[model samples]
Target: MKTKHHILTYALLALSISASAQYGSQKKADNLFNKFAFADATKIYHHLIEKNFNADFATRQLADSYAYMRNPDSATVYYKKAVQQDNVPIDYYYNYAQALRGIKEYKQSRLWLKRFKEAGGLIKKDRYLKDNDFLNSIFNAKHHYFLAPVNFNSKYSDFGAFEKDGTIYFASSRNLGTLKKHVYGWNHEPFLDLYTTAKRTDSIVNHKSKIKGDINSVYHDGPLTISKDGKTMYFSRNDFNKNVLGKDNQGVTHLNIYKATLVDGKWTNVEALGFNSNSYSNGHPALNNDDSRLYFTSDKPGGFGGSDIYYVDIKADGTFGTPQNLGNIINTNKNEMFPFINSENALFFSSDGHAGLGMLDIFATVTDDNNNIKSIINLGVPVNSSKDDFSFFMNKDGLSGFFASNRAGGIGGDDIYAYNRIPQLKIEGSITDATTNAPVPNAVVTLLDSNDNKIADLLTDENGHFEINIDRNTNYKLITQKDNYIDNSRTVSTKGIESSVTSIKANFVLNPVAKKEVPISELYPIYFDFNKYNIRSESTAELDRIVDLMVNKYPYMVIKIESHTDSRGSFAYNDKLSKERAKATYNYLVANGVNASRITEFNGYGERKLANGCDGTKNCTEAQHQLNRRTQFIVVKME
Candidate 1:
């Protein structure tokens, strides 16, 4: 993820500037923009643009207003115009790229990103320079998702989905009659409130309603977490009370996490967490499986990025411990938020700090026993896109769950989407020696798809057992090879597997290559026309098999190709023809990927080693003569 400064912070900065009489309308629009009042600011900026008053600046500000409002459609229009102006700031170009990505215009987004990088005044190196190929590879990669929009989405922002006990809890700005209606200036939408729905099916949901209580407030609320026991809950809300509205030095109110306990079937005792502060924002809380640790995102100072994921320990006496930053492995110089921990202790979060397709992408990482973050992996599209994606939640099964994305075709500004992971097929078996029927440990097994494209490579464990997951409804070939053994392969297909995870047995038995030479005729016969030196088409399959063995199985083995002829012509002429045939065989192997250096020699042995009595003086059937006129391969050296 490239570091694009948080546009919301810029809006706050704009509010701090004093108004000047010389630029009355412009100053007013700037003031509105700083207050996160994007809707009204948009109008003021648009009016100034119509009057042709500082049109370029108005255009950029207008775009910023829509962008911060999560309306990429309108933002792109003004951003496109703003970037055309001479000496436009590099951030504008980056903003334009994000807008393009929001609409699924990836190709155009990439082009704008190129221009952003070329402008070249970045403090942090562009991640795209190293991850463009990787990000692009996702389009062609196998994705198991079966994605669909949730049924209850409204035109307003609807996101932050979490499922517990067959009921789905989410945060949305949809208006309700019982709640006092107040619009958030950021998007001119009703302040967010927690809502719940019941799952009808894996892909369908029903019974949407806002939670009833003091939880619904005039200010923003929700994007919550429930304890495993379902008795306690932690949720995000603005730091505003009836008496006082908390504000930071920048005059921007921040979010805080509050805890509420279920008493007599009602959520009560809502209190802010001890660690929350007015000086910095903290929200989007998630608890570990046992609720011993709480994870949340914050823009607190001394953090590595704009917002970073942090966790605090919950003691036995219900006391809190010092918050700990997840560190660089999970946090970067850009925002990382919306942390979710699955059953496997793998942490999933959204980050704009890693290399991704576009704006914030969802990433997952596992931690060791010491609770240190390890490698991080992108969820990839269609789970992730060029638009802001966050608030990921899934079950222990890893088969299905919900996430939020502002990608195109969504039902609202940021819609909650349900996804089911298609069933995966597995191929599992053991490798053994043909002679002894004993496990062959450490044998290399390679998997290839129908097109002979390599899929995966594995080594047999001490028990000679190996198991690997493969794509469903695909044909595959498994090649098993080991030192001093003849390689073998088996074809397997999962075209009809219907289970969530189907495991099919596919065993391999490899023969040990004898100390003496092994004849190629034992594997497959090679036939030729009476006087032809060119390879026959029927022999290609067998020849390719040999090539695969030499390249993958016996890298240190050298081979010798022997071509012979029946005692029909003069020895000199027969020898010359035999040599040509042997050379043709050798060339085919080399062209098919077997290294030329691996072939020790190819020689003609005309009538010297006849398979049967087929001498020129004696009359013999054509079958007997054909047996004498043949090509053979043997291992000349093995090291």
Candidate 2:
């Protein structure tokens, strides 16, 4: 009994110490993460994990650490492990949902959020209204269903859905392999085909099963959209078979859109949308409610780049006019495809070329009377991922939709996921100069995707206020740049977090040199030890001023570094020193990121070029000598 008691006492002591240590470690980890020392916090979490102390929280903490460190991939792996441990808190689900969103698992994130809510998790409904992840810019409390990409059974990798009555139509490339040969050494999957599923409107979420369609093809076919009246159907297909035959077919290998008429509740043979479907390749069609215009994707020449959204106005005879480029405002030198126009006159689309959540997430905008459209705003976290997420479609009511993604937990490559739109909203903020406190107006504000594309350029107002409407489920890079100031950037991803407006203030201090009148010459100054070639300490101060000047006028101004030597040295020696001096100055400026184009040739006038009559004697006065031993900045060009 005595020995047993001793052992028991020892066991209790050990347990106490272990518990205390675990709590202490957790505190340290929290502190580290709070300070943004993600790497350091990660180390501590790993140590706790190895000890098997609070394994669930430790793993999650580690995952959060990775997220804070800007390493989402690693965070995702750990978050999954934590979830697997079971008995994890709803907060774990929240963080895991965020990781899923960061990696472009919009559907999966939705599932997690749903699970969190169902598990007695109470979150502010208005949180998403202001959160960066919520981009819909409109909200409805009744629309609460979130479609998690993981909810799709592995049997079908589907996306881009349009519903009518009891059936929901979506795109999938499962089984049929007509485009299999068109792998093109890339990740091209089988051509997508439209499928229908059963649905009911009463439940928060309605399950779907694929429906048969006669227009199914061996080629890529899918991303089917229907007009408001459900009389017109649009889908995308690609003839990869042409490439399998070793034929040079540029237009066929890509996507080709088709239009079909729904007669007597059945879809007929799809007809090519005509000249709008030219040799350059066009696909991803979205018809306006009026049926007078069809928006589609095309990579035709004279466009901003690989693919740009183009539309054809329907003529009275049911024919389309020549496709006109949507100009640089909406199109960029990047791929902008997969468009969906909702009944509300809002345009939804996916893009790698536009700023977004990840590789390719959905974006939307409302058009104005001037034909000018608002910026394409990314659908936040739960609906977007770091992987390719294209093929977005929505119903007229904005309650349900579909999108494609190749994120983790999917059945295969680029699986199509279904999701009910969360009624949350998008809120945007603009950064301005505090002193002027006025809008930094016309500042180039770029939203980066996972692929790092500047998705949009936001201009500030007279109040220095820039704002954007957003939907739930997206990620973005908010970067601002203006003349005479530093470029500032921020990364925001909203997954399972609360919906709340987040305002970021990126105020810039415009340098005096960045203003008019202060020329490049005003910034450069070369110092010398009386008449010597060696750079002096005083010159560093002058050079620092130049460095500041360059920062203010980046991407503009072209200047040259020229050096001269006094007659006190031999012609040969003076020439060599002058060259060294010029090179030194040039190297310094270049190292500091002054554009190489801004500064050009460095001429060594040596003693051959004397600023003042360098009395050809070593005993010259300092005033006369100072002229020949120096460097100056000459402006080559100005913006």
Candidate 3:
């Protein structure tokens, strides 16, 4: 792909620079900037800024120069200030967002991307907005990878790893023990060249030498792919063929994909592909499992975004078929490049088009026999970060692999990392009230592992959220308890989970104890045989329920006991009998551990609280008279 200079407008931007008229001539600075001489342009821009000469305009041009120079940390500092100007173009917002990712400011990156979208710039559809659990899934997938740096990493950019015959072939800008004869203006580093390393055992080999087939060019080259048969290879390089560097009408050199044959232990018959054009770029080639199809990235017309992945059939006679686009399912309005098809036919590529943790994330796709994409998944975490992660390659076993990332803690501009799959499992969990569905905050949760050992003691937050990390192929039990709610527990297992799944979510709810009103509206018969006062065995069970609530459930509940008698007995005798019955009920509760002070009153009404006018002379049935022989425990003060 062409560098950022291809997009810089000299005449228009220079005119705009002059229009900002708070300064001396900005023509020289704008001219050098447009001429791809960013180093000189940056110096002039800095000089103008030091003079306070059109500072905002100079700052924006300065940031663009640094961006084209491949220093995002420096570019972002100026971009952050330049984008704040009201007259700045919408593209600045988008560029600022991209620059932010280089510094791992993902939250700010997304914000700027959103602001870019609001300012009428095209942006990828955020799948996260449609799926609430999308981001958690990313966090879980991140645990599956363990990334480590290679021993051969240099102070310069070292990336693009490919492996065959236990030998690693990679691209590097290292000088190979010589002073820099030629340096790319983009990053001021030596132009990239193909390098080889001999893999001995489990560890990655160090950089030993370059390819031995007249492949080392004085210009930029490399990032090659070897066929399964190891008989043929395809690689990327500048438009340098036959000692001539081709340039387009814009006077910019574009990259081209070239095919080479391995003969007599050395590469030979190198030539550019049929689709090579001086106008656009075609590079980062990949080959399918059987070598019948060759895939590569290009920015040719009539495709989506900045770049797209295309493939061609490798004819038997060494001719190539027409290139076909991978289609919208795999391509997006943003970039999709560096395609790698593993032995299992899974297509892995790097992209900023898909919603991910940050800038460029590696993605994999499930493809059908005809190369039709079925699904796309983000390879979250260790293999990816907020920086650019691309050029993914894997061994035949699919367990071990390598890729490049410019994320933090790297050795150079971009560092190649070796990685293997590491299974990650955790529980994305929540707690809530079972009745109202409201969050149950401050709930104590206990976790027991498969071995019946307490593993974690967790307390939920105000929003009823708890994170639990667990093991694969194991069973776990969760017990949650909270104040004013009944204790509850649940059992979960990670057994039989698919290999791709990283986490098993555990959500729980709690139910508040029932709050029954305490009144005499529905009273049970408190019948004593004729004139006696004693608790019945059957009635005592129901009475114990009230005692349990006051003593165990709600310890602060206060109540008063009341008993009534029918009109059959004399008023004075009935009153005394009723008082005895009330005292008996209260004694039962007090004996059952209910606090004595909780019994606010114990009184009785004798023939006064009557039912159905059943006076002694009225000749009422026993059932009708029994209605008045009832007890009431009225709630006085229940906290």
Candidate 4:
């Protein structure tokens, strides 16, 4: 036994020596790799193979070196050789998978990803998807990436990209010692500069073109909207026009729209666009395909609130008339910016005031007839997160474009992200009380798909407004209910319609279900945090009591659960949150075995008063204030 142990120890030591020697070669390769001397690293790695050294690691290193050198074909050969020798390191698998994906070996790359995931590898999904050298063409490929935030460095950042005209235009605020940074000095960089890359498409590093004649001097030069004719350029800059030079020489004070004419294909003459240029912040311009009209953003007091979409017709006299604010329906008291008009005349913008997946998200709204907000739909995930996601620009095909986000994980601060906007369907509406005719604030609205499985739950606003964006090709049952009130429901079909946004008005009227003498119990079971109308677990028991009463009183009574929030912020903001919170509690009930059809409504009050003192005041304790945060049940049907 002692002799056997000695033999095993010696064998183990020999294997360790071999692994250590192999690792040493890989280490040397890594040093060269870090310096970006790929060619030299490849040479050294190949030399190891010639010496019959740890060829597995050497071959993989050689493959990476070749890939960095843009010699993908040679890289593939070496990667395959390494894999053949059981060289299945996570890095090796990731690199090899990327190489395969680059060469269009999608199936094989997927197999490798499975193996890589199984190996417990922590690979960066976003890096792989965004890397030009990697295969990023597959649909839904970005899902693997862990969303992280871009580090908050002081560099001005916005969405930017290389234009088809060979002029590289992007939003930035690098300062470069400019006078006063930007006009408003909003947290984002004040001056977004336009840079062009010298037509050297050979190397990725050489892509940065020069800025054309310091066109970006003071103000915010960003969201560049270039003309297809290449003879004109339209951009959104802070309200500081060189033409607006003050008597005492104070700088332009507001963001305004500007146009530059390309003389001899060179952008030389820049002029402040006529009447359209306002004293308020007017920026983030988007153009019609024909260049006949300009679409932009402004907060000129006449607007809906923070900022709203405004359009001006390019008159035959080469002057813009009065800019028109897209009405109250489209513009809310909440901030709306980054308006992009597509070829279809469909308007796309970013809004914190709309129902969305995050802080600021991309939304598409159609302005029809009276230019009302016909349909307001959210552009969901990958394109939207719980961050400040905005600055939308899509290509003609409408498949891809660039957007700016401070979301997690990027090469730099607030890196510009390219995403494919997946088409979706959004259902929106208001839930009100049938009896009171008042908005049934804090109501739960659950939507079940064709399989009778609950798909989404949305709450109504202070005014009982709700909006939901989802995918099409499904049947849905919208159930609304609140404590003490009967529940209500409606069947909706999302098929055969290209509607991205649809609004319905559904309200539930609650009949007194339990005898008033039973107990002076809470009207709703859901509770909100102090000053918040959002539903909390503490309110469940009270809500359950109502649900039990409904189940017993009429035996067949269908109840609707709804939520409400007090008004605090802007209507757009309060309205959106109130609607969502109402639906959350509705979902909880349905998940707990309540009949979907029996539950009728969910709603949010936003800042609307349910009880006057509930809107958060020092006059009440946090506990008492929480009493105002509640969910209600309305009897929808007694069968």
- Find the 10 residues in a row with the least total lDDT in model 4: 5-14
**How large is the C-alpha RMSD of every model relative to the true structure?**
21.2, 25.8, 23.4, 28.3
Candidate 3 or 4, higher TM-score? 3
Ranking by TM-score: 1, 3, 2, 4
Per-candidate TM equals: 0.52, 0.41, 0.48, 0.40
Compared with the true structure, all predictions reach lDDT values of 0.75, 0.60, 0.73, 0.58
Residue-by-residue lDDT tens digits, candidate 3, 1-639:
122132111000001223223222355676454333466667778877776655667898889777755568998999999897755778798778767877888888889879888887755557214433456546643276776557877777777788898888888778667744588877677878888886523333323477868676877787889988888889888889999999899898888889888888888888999988999888888888788888888778899976778889999997899999989877887777788878755678877778877766788774332445645667887787888788898887565779987788887877788986644456768889988999986677777765544554556766887664566878888878676665677789888997667667788878674476544343344565556678777788778887777777778777668788888767788998888999999898888888898886687887788766888767888788877887777665555
Q: Write the per-residue lDDT of candidate 4 for residues 1-639, one digit (tens) a residue.
A: 012111111100002224334434545665554333455567678776775555555676688766655555687788878676532456677667777877888778878766776787654454444544222232223331222232222244535443554444565555454345443333343445665543323223211433564356554565567766776777655455664532212433555566887665467677767754344556767777688888877766666666677788887877877788877656788767777766555677787777666577777663323433445646566777777677766666454456677676654445566554433346677766555677766677777766655544445656666655544656778877566665567788766774323343334554434443433343444667644544456667765666566555545666555555554457667666766777877776676656777765566666674555655444555556545556666554556
Evaluated at residue 36, the lDDT of candidate 3 is 37
Error of 2 at 312 (Å): 0.9
Q: Best candidate, lDDT-wise?
A: 1
| Candidate 2, position 256, lDDT | 62
Local error of candidate 2 at 562, Å? 82
lDDT of candidate 1 at residue 47, scale 0 to 100: 80
The per-residue C-alpha lDDT of model 3 at residue 550 equals 77
lDDT of 4 at 635: 53
Name the weakest run of 10 consecutive residues (lDDT summed) in model 2: 5-14
Best by TM-score: 1
